[model samples]
Target chain A: MFFIGWLVIIKNQKGKSWIKLVESKEIIEIFFHGRGGQTAITASQLLAEMAYEKGFIDTIAIPIIGAERRGAPIMAFTKISEKKQIRTYDSVKEPDYMIIFDTSLLDIPRIKDTIKEGVIIIANSPIPIDTTDFPDNVKIYIVDATGICIKREFMHSSGPILNIPMLGAFGKVTGYYDLEIMEKVLKKEFGEKKVEKNMIVATDAYESVKEV
Target chain B: MSKARKDFTQEQETKIIKGNVSAAYAAKSARVQVIGAYPITPQTTVVEKLSEFVDSGSMPGTQYIKVESEHSAMASMVGASMTGTRTFTATSGQGLFYMNEMLHWATGTRLPIVTAIASRGPAPPWNIWADFTDVISQRDTGWMCSFCATHQEIYDEILMSYKVCEDYEILLPKFVAYGGFILSHTSKPVIIEDQEAVDNYLPPLPDEKGWPHIFMDPERPMMFGNLIMPSGFYSEFRLKIHDAHMKAKEKIKNAAKEFEKSFGRNYGNGLTQQYKMNDAEVGMLIYGDLALQMEEAVDLVREEGYKVGMVKLRYFRPFPVEDIINIAKSVKVLGVMDRATAFGSPTGGPVSSEVKTAIEGVEKTAKILPMIGGLGGREVTLEQQTEQLKILIKMNETGDAPGDLFHGTLWHGKLEVE
Candidate 1:
């Protein structure tokens, strides 16, 4: 039973406890932008599982599905809350964080325009992004998630499996979870055989990710 | 910490799973004997995962059937159901439309078949996205159609549907519907109950004796579903289907109550669940994925010190007329929101029209603001839902209607094509 053990905030009202819990703190919304083959959607889900495993009261992973081809740009969002149930399934607009799987996605206007003031950006790039057009006071962390995946031999059929390392970098950047939490979730999702390789790439990005 | 171990027989497992996966797990938990499947967008993964479960020998007791089309998929389910086995299948949008005739065949034969619907918009702009037009279009088919507001509810409701649908008093087919991509594709934390807990909650799987309703054995051979003339039991049978739907309301509520007692999840009497409606003067009646968001919308609206509430319409076929009427009477104004369209209907939205019909002659009824939006997987934000509640409050304060009322219904969130 997910969150059944977490009955810390019990509201004995005529309305009930779930609604009362959902009305607590503002939810932490993270948006992920990636091309179709890149596994941004899985990154979103994995991030949710990791956060929830690390004791976030509630979380949801929403992927915007479309007629996507291999190279077509796709989007997903993960909303995790510290003390509240995530009732809304809407895609994040004014996101607290953005995970960019490719640097070239910023060239697309729709993706670029969502970079709001004071938002933190974690992009999978080997170098600092051109931030001449980025909003003021925005924090950006750059990780060579692709580079780490290749070095660790985390090659899926399409390319490097980007989500595992990307989420590993995310855990380090946000401090919402750690490599241990990622290990627990990855072992659960990918199982023991696949978890070793996945964690190898994950630890690479976890140790190497830095603010630009 | 080791919660996601491969073994599933003992302890309950909680995992972040797609809604389609939840439905598939529900079928596995229910010990469904047969699956008739045809792949469609948004619904493909459900049958795909069920096939995986069957192929991997995890569900060795189950039989998986791959059919060419949605019609054959349901036709196979009807045939399987006749043999008195717990049968399941899933389809969406055009696939549901293709299975229309068999949908009636499943219900009219009084089979306890359960189908998961990743509801999508009807085709011809050739759309395959979230919309309830497909399931609601099966209104006359006599299947008990229910909507799920959360990912967990998709699993809970399917298990509950079996209890209600398999009841001798209401041996009817059912559709557990949710928004296609909005729910079906999205992943969320869902609690997968252990086999022991599920078996304890649900009725025992029919023994080798087959289902008692229509047990087909070589020793006890009997013909079923023979053609009936106009003067025959045709009219009686039709009346009995309607009678069972009316009775299903109570059975659904009981199942929800027992589920809460057994599994500790509350679904507000199963037909319609309410949030903060007791002290509210205005409320919103909604269903499917949007209703979960509206709870947040209601909480946000309540933070501003306005009396607002919400009700998620859980079951559509039973209609839950008494509950709808009670909700209407308790509020000063009620907004009926629909994520599916109903062209030429009185309210221009399916559920809103039903709400109107439900309270037609009710005394001192609340003003109903009929609304339709979020169709074809359109994004209806929390702010938009909060705005709709504000519109209802304003409608209560001042007797003026909002602008751009097509046939006196609000067609909200349409793009401005200048």
Candidate 2:
């Protein structure tokens, strides 16, 4: 009877194999929470472009548009798929990954609630964060992206451009992309003059990012 | 007006680009000679990209006119078209609404000028998200309207738009619209075809003689849009425009066939494309970006032992009536989804109302479920779409409609009010 029950379980799993494959090969949806002018929205687009350049079959970067101010909260979503086309254009509700460009965004209830079980987070912070409030299934990684940007002198008129470093840390943790792919896409997007400096900060963040 | 054709041996390149940029690339590839520009959200980047191309001398000899308003943009396109050049421009939402006056002027003059529209919701509170009402509202403007579901289709359809619109037998302005931000802002890999192959496919730019009817030549200047008496061919001109639109249905199909032969890409009859509909008992008719996602929903629902299919309505003005009738006959129940509002119209949604009219006199047809969602860029997730499919199946099985049917239409995804 135990063997028959085991067989039944296996049969059910077999019947639902397509769902499993879909989940496995599913588009990786990543949510970004940041302050305006921190470049989180651009990060979302850069990540998609980099993933596509790295040979992912499809990618879409969506920015949630609203009234904008210099330091107001902003949100964006990037989805990258390996084989199947990413069709739905909805904002990611249950993201596989999250990038917090400003760790203070975690204090906002709406941003905090976006955190769910089984999500890997790569946050830009100079110090470790208190993850006790998060579910146990969630993993947290941190990189001093802002510090790296300062160190590498990657800044615009407002402040440090955080997208490259955040993307760098993301690449290091998830292995979705790498420094090489980063250089290639950045050079193409930002042109040759800025690529070297951008890669400097990106490389620093990639090497220094660590689990919290 | 035949010129020496360029070589066609160069390979096509695929680039990860936004839908707006894809439209710009299509205009560049089609070698559009005149570009009228006005900045609007989502659509601004399209003209920006073109201006850059022109500034860099990549599009040599092309004239870029920076217009102050969308009205002037369309007016400039009409003026340029009268001068015998391939003309193109793009606009969205309020910009499209502003151009309403000139839209009639282009089609009335029978100029084959092509325009891309990044469709957005009309506003009282204001919105910049994906909605189709802005384009659908122009249905009576005598222009051929089509929607694209993917980035590559945005490029391919514009190329095909010029091919169909420029045909002497069907000289009509066409609007190739896609959902704002949903398509306009999203990035995807799209193949930019070889220019030589495109040139070979599209008709050569008209010579100085201009279109068959009108031209702006110093040697023999002609007048256009002059007043005509009520008894003097005014009614006849209107009838001819109607006649050309009816005839364009065939020209569009032939253009799609020839495009496929040259580019090796198929767009399912150029009117409507179907997915898994051969033995479907329940189906949905959708267009624009939503149609692509609906395919995924159909796939998921089919996995659960349900017979579901999807038909993507490509051309709106040429209203794929025969295709809708045929699909209606195949399904027990059909859901027509629209992302645009029709206010107090028969169905409260644009495409659904059209679907009802198309199947009105059919001998055997599915019961139509008029549905609306994703207005103003409301996120219609795949799960919601799966539920939508299940609702269709339930309606088929139980012979009952879904709840929240306002005036016999299901307004899905409404927020609860306390």
Candidate 3:
């Protein structure tokens, strides 16, 4: 009887640890691939802020540091979790979601090879991507963020400020955050004067984003 | 120099800010009188935020001096600190190396100046990444050095530092350091305490008498750090500085207790924080940002039925010898992990070497494993930490060291080179 009770205790302990692991493993790891001055790094931070505002308990945005020039490919990451604190500072190697600011970057082997099976890709392109080369379980979504940025005249010196629209389409695709949380975080970060134009691009991308 | 006493009656607010910004907020909350500014990557944002605070008139009557070099930054801070006002500055990597000259001056003069260091790796390879070698290299500079593992600690430690440094018995400058980019760039939610609470906790700003020993009054004027003959009190002054640092251990513990009483946060006796060590046969001793992550590793390892625990060495200067010996008694195997190198030293790692020296004369049963990793901002993942704990457990059970023991140290996480 004592051995049977001990086995039951060990089973209960194992069950609890397994549940804790699973709950902590629900963290959403996202990778952003963009050219320099495309606002991808800022988008990583803004996404963490948005998720936190939307009630995620823990979030971290990591921007890769390097000597980046205009049009040079750069990468950033955001890890958002609801329960556990994000402890690791390493870059996301197996991202659950990938965001591409420029569709042409898809040609880069380094960026292309990172998209694995069961991963979702959100691209800022006018039309859908040709996913014939991608794995069967991979899903790709496209939104004309540049068109929306131009329509709303939301641009900086280099190019369209694609972070808001990209983040908007991301919110639509993942349902992790919504328009309300975006507006709340944007108003806090970018101030009231710039919120109108930002929301214009953000809403357009939200409504137009479609899975290919 | 004569300005009204600012009534900082604002309510405390919690913000999700980067660790560098948290350092800026701590300075602002302390109402520091003089700030020496120089910009360097990672450490740049800290001075930038403080400049914003000064420019917006939010921090009234604060003199923000723009310096051309890190040397001038520390020199100007020394000038201001001599005038009996609270002074603060920050630097990183090459900038810290540049300020090494004044680092000695601040301690020799015995001013209670507080400087935050977003620690980065030494160069020659031109890298600006998280490594503690920049600050640890200054171990002989006579400044009390403390490592912070969390964003909130970055703020709280600075506040407590001023409290301990300004004590009449312990008028010593201190460096509060954290991993560059790891803590400096990462954003986390931190609670900024109300100004009233801070004012009650910290000692009042120094007056015309300046420090207890030195005075900067022009009328009763005096020259400081003047030329001392070799046969003079130079050695005596050095011995005095050493003595003060040795006595600061008690003052730090008292300040930490008072801070917890006032701010309601515990820092584990202000020297070392133990996690899950109640019934552990093996444990790891680490510091800086890695220590926080090690807590998660300890929890995961304990769930696997291994009695694994961790101890975070907070203060490196005072060495925490008593705490080290006490913690050494609890576990059979202890791993001393350093994120900085002390190349050519006994253990090749600064903290582990110190730990070995700390336990030399003590009667202890624990076998010490000296380990080093995360240099030059190398990534130390949670999975790797779990595996490290398993290695410690294996070594304890088998009475054999793990593989890749280079010169009596396990340099974990090195890339496979042909």
Candidates in descending DockQ order: 1, 2, 3
TM-score of chain B of each: 0.96, 0.97, 0.98
DockQ winner among the candidates?
1
Off by over 4 Å in 3: A1-24, B1-9
Model 1 ranges off by over 4 Å: A1-25, B1-10, B205-213
Model 2 misses residue B323 by how many Å?
Answer: 1.0
| CA shift of A31, model 1, Å | 1.1
lDDT of 2: 0.88
- Candidate lDDT scores, in order, read 0.88, 0.88, 0.88
Q: Report the CAPRI category for model 2.
A: acceptable
Clash pairs for candidate 3: none
TM-score of 3: 0.94
Question: Scoring each candidate complex against the real one, what DockQ results?
Answer: 0.40, 0.39, 0.29
- TM-score of candidate 2 chain B vs. the reference: 0.97
Q: Higher DockQ: candidate 2 or 3?
A: 2
**Which pairs of residues collide in candidate 2?**
none
